[model samples]
Target: MERVHSDRSEQLYQLYKPLLFSLAYRMLGSVSDAEDIVQEAFLSWSERRPETVLNEKAYLCKMVTNRCVDRLRSPGKQREVYVGPWLPEPLITEALDSDSPSGAYLQKESLSTAYLLLLQQLSWVERAVFILREVLQYEYDEIAEIVDKSSSNCRQIFHRAKRSVSGLSGMADTVPLKSESLKALIEQFIHAVASGNTGQLMNLLKADVSMHSDGGGKVTAAVRPILGADRVIAFLMGIASKAPADMSFRIQMVNGNPGIVSYIGEQPSSVITFRMENDRIAEIYIVVNPDKLKHLPQR
Candidate 1:
């Protein structure tokens, strides 16, 4: 690869930063690591001459992918060293805008909390294959080149990845509905919890509503599931008490669903998402672990 001049490199970095960041983030499931990987790719690009570079986009993307694959393979140590539980980095996007079926946001399954949680179940290769296939739709050959594997090997990896991600032997059409009834139920439930209106919340909650928290052991939380509406409420209040003193709550669309964030000193500290069934809220997932909230930047 030929070295790019200083000015040319700046332009190239600006041009590719968004693409690289998105690719790295999705691949690694770590915003900080993704940013680091992209930066490293650019550094590698700089070290080579522009004369040596034949295909800039492909080269940069491949660099990022290779680094991400190694990181994925290497994170067992960090996962082991991590205190308590670990969760995926949280990122808040603009509300599920205009799901009228023509929007750019992948409306395939309405980015819900349930969906992201399921993503946690996939192996790194499977996640990478599924993301490239479903989210980016790259050809298997191109994917093989990026991952440095045989075409057949890549196909097999993708096949298994597809099954793991979809949790089915075959692909399913996963269109999500924007149920107004579910939103109403959750809004009322949040009010009940925030305002300590337990009676109204109880009437609305199921007898066995399950609640989970990704505290990452930085803060005290239930290591296992907290079952029942009564127990769920108690657990949530405990979380509220531990929230930063100046923290404020707001409702936002995250992963394409109604979600909550706690902003302490005007920076996001936590994000919570809900799962609903038949117009009623079924589960509440709280992600307070600082490592995961880095992606939800204020801007």
Candidate 2:
């Protein structure tokens, strides 16, 4: 009987693992942390008798959501004085690279680096409620159950989260630049930076573009966001001047969008992603922390 129950629990976990992981990842923005929460949730499930659970999916979702909330409320000690900017850990989802037209926008928008960054503004509960309601299509009652809030309160939280991030929700998707076009833009920008062509770089950016770098205090990076086209160009050129002769750049798909990865003699140095609006670059995110890039698969 115990073996049968265990088998049943494992089957259910497989069925819901992706959904649960997506929820946790979106909530926490750290692949390892989300994986940890999902694993612990499965362990909890394995210890329970199947008969005691009324709805397996809801039960698992609630467990994962609550765990993520706890993690958010009390972040890991290492992050207390994280150096420079603290961008979300990049996730490589190759499946997104070959998405079908019908689901392309939906998949791209949901996991885009811009959307994930915007999600950081909300409180844990509000983030949970907003992701469950807006992104995952969960009903208020279901979200309330997951977050331990009343349905009414969950609805209010969702509304507030929605309003807070409304203007930025489509920051990365509004332009819909073709993949080839995006690659071309990235190449053009790279060439301009390499040659110290400030005029060319400025033409590639929107008027109010910003650059953000996360060095996690392990390496050198901008202590604050660099804003405006001129300032961003200057920052990029300054970093370029310091680049080692052996450093190389590779075009890669990062978080379901076009991104550039920098390599310093086979060591991953940094990952850069651009957000396009009105046929120009609007926002730039660069992650240079060696600690964050440790998850990249070896070449």
Best by lDDT: 2
Highest TM-score: give the candidate number.
Answer: 2
Off by over 4 Å in 1: 1-4, 75-77, 95-113, 168-175, 179-185, 202-208, 240-247, 264-267, 294-299
What are the per-residue Cα lDDT tens digits for candidate 2 across 100-166? 4323322556677788888987888888898888877899988877778899999999898898888
Q: Give the TM-score of candidate 1.
A: 0.78
Query: Model 2 — TM-score against the truth?
Result: 0.89
TM-score of each: 0.78, 0.89
Q: List the residue pairs that clash in candidate 2.
A: 83-217
Error of 1 at 27 (Å): 2.4
lDDT (CA) per prediction: 0.69, 0.82
**Root-mean-square deviation per candidate:** 4.3, 3.0
